[model samples]
Target: MRAQSGHDPFDLQFEADDDFGPSSDADWRPAGPAPSERREPVEDYSPAPRRRAEAFDDLDAPRPAGSVGDNPVHDMIASAEAAFGDHALPRITIHAFIERPRTGDMIEHAARDRRMERTSVTVRDGGLSAALLAYQNQPTPPLLVVECCAAAPELLAQLDQLAEVCDPGSKVVVLGAANDIALYRELMRRGVSEYLVPPLKPLQFVRSVSNLYADPSAPFLGRQIAFCGAKGGVGVSAIAHNIAYAISEGLGANAVLVDLDLPFGTAGLDFNQDPLQGVADALGEPDRLDPVLMDRMMARCGEKLSLFAAPASLDDDYNIPPEAFEEVTQKVRAAAPFVILDLPHVWTAWKRRILLSSDDLVIVATPDLASLRNTKNLVDLVRRARPNDTPPRLVLNQVGVPGRPEIAAKDFGEALGLIPALVVPFEPKLFGQAANNGQMLAELAPKAKTTEALAQLAQQISRREAPVAQKSSLLAGLLRRK
Candidate 1:
C-alpha cells in the first residue's frame, strides 16, 4: 500500500506459470554446465533475462505433458479451493522492486492473479540510500521482491535500511545480477528468504516467492470480499452489511465492513451508529495510515464486527482517486482477517479497481427484468475485468412480491446463466421493523422467515454450509417447527 494515490487514467485493463521442485517450489531444470555463481549476506543476484518469456524459457525443458488438473500445482490449487471460494477476497500482498522494467512487467503478470490482494512495483533507482528512502515510509509489504544489480558493498547499507523499515515478519526475496553462491548464502543469513540469479523467468520469480508463503497459515492469505450493485436500489449495501455482520458474529470470525457508499452509505444506518470519520478520514491522508491509524478509523459494533464506515456528507466531493482505495484496502487487508467492501452502484476507475481486484464478489439483485439484465451484464463485465478471479455470487432478493409481475426463480437463473445462491423472499414487515430498530435481522426477528433465510445465506458465505439443492422456505420450516 505504498502511497501513490493518483488514478493513472492512462492505463487500461485486459492487460495480461509454472513447474517447480523442492528448490523453492519452482524447480526449473537448470540448463547445461552451470554458469559462475556467487553469494553474500546483504545482497545476491547474477544476471537474469529482463523479459518474461526468456526468464521462464530457462525452465521450459520438456517433461511428460499432463493436464493442470493432474499436476501437483493444480492439486494444491484444488485443495485450497475453499480459501478461494465465492464471495470474498483472499488477502495477499506482493511488493517487488525491479531494476529492469521489462523484467518487472513480466514478473507482475505472473503473480497478478494467484489470489494476491495487491502486487505493487517499486522501481529500482539511484542508489542504496534512494531505494531505502523510497520504501521507508511504506510498511514492508508482506512479500518483498527486489531485483537489483547493486554490488555487495552497496547492498549492505541498503539491506540495513530495509531491515530498519521492514516489519520483523515481512518476507524478503532478492534477485541479483550474477550467480554469486557466497552472496546467496549471505543474503539467506541476512534474513532474505531466497536469492536468485537474474535473466530468470516470470515463473521463477513467482514460484520462489509463492513457495515461501503458500498456505492460509502464511500472513496475508486471508479473504477480502467486496459487495457491489449493477444498478441503484439493487440492495448491495444492505446485503453487504448483513453478510459482514454474520461473518463476524455468527461465524465467529473477525470481519471488517467498509462502506464505500461515501456520500449515501447506509452502513452506519444499517448498523445503527454514527462514527466520527469514515472512508474520507482514511483516504484523506493516505500516507499517515498504519495499524494504529486504522484503529482510529474503526467503530466496533459487536464481538468480532468492526466497520470503516463512510462519512455521510457532501461537504466536499469525495473525488477519491484510485490510489487512495489501493492504500486503504491494502492496510485493511493486512490488519483484518476478512474485509468486506460495500461499493456503490456506480462505476469509476477506483470502483472498478476495487471490484476487479477484490478477492471475492457478491452482486445483490431483485428478480425483475431490469435487475436480471443489469446483473447479467455486470456478471459478464466483471468476469472479463477479473479474468483471474472466480465469478461473482448473485443474490436474488425480494422474490415473490404479491401482485407484482416477477421473473420465475428458475427462469431468472436461466436468463443470467447463473443459479441464484440465495433467493431472499419478500418480507416488508420484518425488514422494515429491523431497519427501523437499527438491528440485524437475526437480532430484530430471529424467528422471522427472511431473518432465518439471511442466517442460511451467511452460513453459505462463510463456508459453514456448502451449496446444495434449492432450499425450502424459511416460512415453511417455521410452520413445520410450529
Candidate 2:
C-alpha cells in the first residue's frame, strides 16, 4: 500500500467566486457602485380601523380575520427556532500579504476553518507596501492582515502610510518578525487590532481573527477527548471507534472522530468508509478548512456522525509538526460539539502534548507486564502534568485470553491505583467478525459482554451517569467463572 501524506487524496480543490472578477484595463482600480441620481416618492399607507371587542387588544387575543400578523403563536415558535439554531458567524473578508510561503500557507489554511466559512480570504506575496498600494483608491475590507519584515523604524513608517488609506471601520492585524515590545506597543496605540510574531501556528492565526468578533455571552465551545494505547496492537483503535459510535449514535450529539494515526489509522475501515480527502487533507492545508470544504471531505456515517479518516499510506512520510496538529485539532473542535482523537502509541513531543492537553484521556491496555508498565508511566505523567484534570481512565482489553497467564483485574487496578473503566475479554470471533464486516461491536452483538462493557465506558466518558454507579468487576467475574 502506498503511504499517503497531507495531499488531498480525492483531489478536491475549492475556488472562490470573486465578486470583483477581473479587470479589462491594467490601470483600473475598484470604485464601489456609482451613486444613484434618481429618487422616487416614498409611499405611505394607513389602514382603516375596525371597531372590535375590547378583548381583541389583549395579548392572548386571536388575530383579526385577515391581518398579516395572523397566527402569532406559530410565528413566535418559528422565530425562536431560527435564533436558537443560528450557527453562522458574521461574514469577514481577509486580505493577507505575508512574505514567506510557509507562513502564507498556514494563514490560508486557518482562513478556511469552519468558523470562517462566510469569510473570504485572499493571501498574496508581499508586505505592508503591497497592501497599501492595493487599497489606495478602493474601499478596505472588513479585516486586513499584513506582514512586514523591515526594521522597526521602516515598518512603523510604512504602517503610517497604511493607516492614511485605511477606511474608518476596518480592522488591521499586523505580522512581523521583530521581538521589540516598543513596536508592539506602538501598533496597539495606532489602533491595530492585533500584532503577531512570525512563525505563527494555524490556531494562533485563527484565534486572533475569532477573538476580534467574539461575543462574551456565546455558548460554550466543544469538548475534546483523546484516546491512546499503552502499546501497539492493544486494541486502542477498536475501543476508540466504538466509543465514537456511542457518542454519535447513542448520545445523539454531532460527533467528529479524528483519526490522528495518519499512516495506520483504522477509523475508515472500522466505520466502513473510504478514507479519502479527510484529516490528512485538512491538516495539509488548514487555511482551506471551512464548513463547506469539511462537509465535502468528511465521510457521513449517520445523521449526527462524521469521520475524519486518516490516509493509511506508506508512500509518503507524514511528519507533521506539533503546532500544525494542535491547530488542526482546534479547528475540528470548532466544527463539532464533540471530538474524539484516535492517537497512535508513539512517544514523541507532539503525542505527549496531545495526551496532556485533552479534556479527557483514555489509555487502553491489556493485562500484561508491558502494558502495565506503560500504563503506569502514562498515568503518572498525565496526572503530574494536569493536576486539575481527572486521572486518565484505564481500559483493560483482551483479558482472559486462554493460557496467557495474565495479571488479575484487581491486581492490575491496584498496581495502577486506578480502577478499570472497561474490561473486555478475549472474544476473538466477535471482534474479528465486527472488524471484517466493518461494524461496531455494539451493532454486531448488542447484548454481548464486550458490548455492554464498551457502552459503560462511553457513558462514563460522556458523563451521562455518575462514575461511582459503574461496575468495574465485569472482567473479574468472567475470569472467575473460567
Candidate 3:
C-alpha cells in the first residue's frame, strides 16, 4: 500500500519509568532510569490532616457517562487527530523536583511521540508540592505530566492539596507507587485524569496518555451516514430512525441511530419507554458530560445498537443556540461506535449546522414536486455551502402514490445528478403498525422489503472512501436563505 500524498506514519520508542515521574533530562548525564525508591521506607512528613472525614466520604466522583449517541470515541479521536495533528504538535509541561528517575523516563517517553513537545524543570525543595504550586501559577499547557513518590498516606494527602491548586483544564496523569485499587478509584474519582500503576511500560505509557489526542476508531476509518427529512408529514424522521436501526441490527457495529429531536421528536417514542433523561439534559451541561453519564442516557435496542434520544418533553422548547452542538455532538461521538443522526426537518441554525457537518447526509423525500423542488434546492445549497463536505446522500421515499402522478426515481436522481440511495415504498400499515407498537421494522417484519432496503443503505454508507467529501446540504441553504 502507498501513502496518501500529505499523510505520514511514524513509530514511538517508549520507556517504562513512571514511579518518580516525567522530566526533560537535558542537564544531567543519563544512566539507566533511577530504580523506584523503596515504598516501605518510613514516612517523615506527617501533619494532622486539615480537611476531615466528610471530605473523603463526599469525595471525588467519576464524571457520569454521556448518552451513547453513535461512535463518540471514534468521533473524539478523529476530532483530536484533526484538531491536534502530528505536525501541529502539543506541548506538555512537566514540573518535578530532584532527579526523579521514574517521572523523568515518562517525560522521555512523551518526547518520543510525534504529537508531544515535552519540557521539564527540576526544583529542589518544591518536590511534588512545589511542582503543583508552580503549575497553578503558570498558564497550563495542553497536557501536564507529573511524577510524585511519597508514602501512600503522604502522597495522597499532597495530591489532595495539589488538586486544590492544579489547573482543572489541563489533563493531569499521576504516577505513584501504591497500586491499591481503592487509591486508584479514589484518584479517578477525585479527578486525577488517569492513574498509572508504577513501572509503566514505555510504549504503553506514551501510547496511553498520548492517545488522549489520537483518532483510533473503526468509523473514522469510514463514512458516517445520517438521515433527515424536510417536514413532519414528509416521512423523514421515520426513514432516519428505521435506517439507523436496520444499520445496527443488520449491519452489525457499522451503524447507530440518534434522535436529536428533544421535545416532540420520536426515537424514544418509536422505541417505546421514557429514559430518565436524554441528550437535552446531557448537553445542558457539557463540562460534566463523560462515559458514566452516557451509559445512563442510552437505551439499548440490541447487542450492537443504542439510541441517543430527545427528551419526550413538550413543556420546554427544543430550540437552542448553534455552538451548543459542537460539544454536545462531540460527547455523543464518544458513546456510539457508529453515529447516525435522525435530524428533524425544522431548519434552525444548529440543525443546519449538524446537517452540513455530517460525513454523509441523506435527505429522505417523497417523489412529489414540492419534495423534488426542496430536495434540489437542498442539494445545490449543501454542495455550495460546505465546499468541503461530502454530497448529501439522496433518498427518495414513497416513490409512487397509488393514484397521484409522481416523478420517476431515476429522473429525480438525474435532475440532481445524484442517485437516490434508497426508494422506500408507501406502506402506511407497515410503518404505522411498527410505530404504534414502538417496534423497529426489522423486529416487526424482519422479512419486510423496507427493512432489507434500509439494511443495504447502511452497507453503502460504511464503505471506507478516502479523502471524504466535505459538503453542506440544502438544509444549510434553507437556513441561510431564510
On lDDT, the leading prediction is: 2
**Model 3: CA > 4 A from native:** 1-224, 254-256, 464-482
Ranking by TM-score: 1, 2, 3
Clash counts for the predictions, in order: 42, 13, 40
* Candidate 3: worst-modelled 10 consecutive residues by lDDT: 58-67
Which whole-number lDDT from 0 to 100 does residue 189 have in model 3?
A: 52
What overall lDDT, based on C-alpha atoms, would model 1 receive against the true structure? 0.64
Q: Per-residue lDDT of 1-482 in model 1, one digit per residue for the tens?
A: 12222422211221111111123323333322242433323321222333334322322221121112333432332234444332222355666766665655666555544443345444443333555676667676677777666666556446655666666567777766545444454565567787776545443454555566556554463467888776788677777888887777777788888888888888898888899876789998888987787887889999888889988897878877889988788778777678888898777888877777776678888878888888888877875454334456678777888999998877877776666667787877877777788888878766866655666666655555423467899999999999
Each model's TM-score, in the order given?
Answer: 0.57, 0.53, 0.52
Order of candidate numbers by lDDT, starting with the best: 2, 1, 3
Identify the leading candidate in terms of TM-score.
1
Candidate 1: segments with Cα more than 4 A from true spot: 1-209, 212-221, 465-482
lDDT of 2 at 353: 74
After superposition, which runs of candidate 2 have C-alpha atoms over 4 Å from their true positions?
A: 1-220, 465-482
Which lDDT value does model 2 have at 428? Answer: 91
RMSD of each predicted structure? 14.3, 22.5, 20.5
RMSD of 1: 14.3
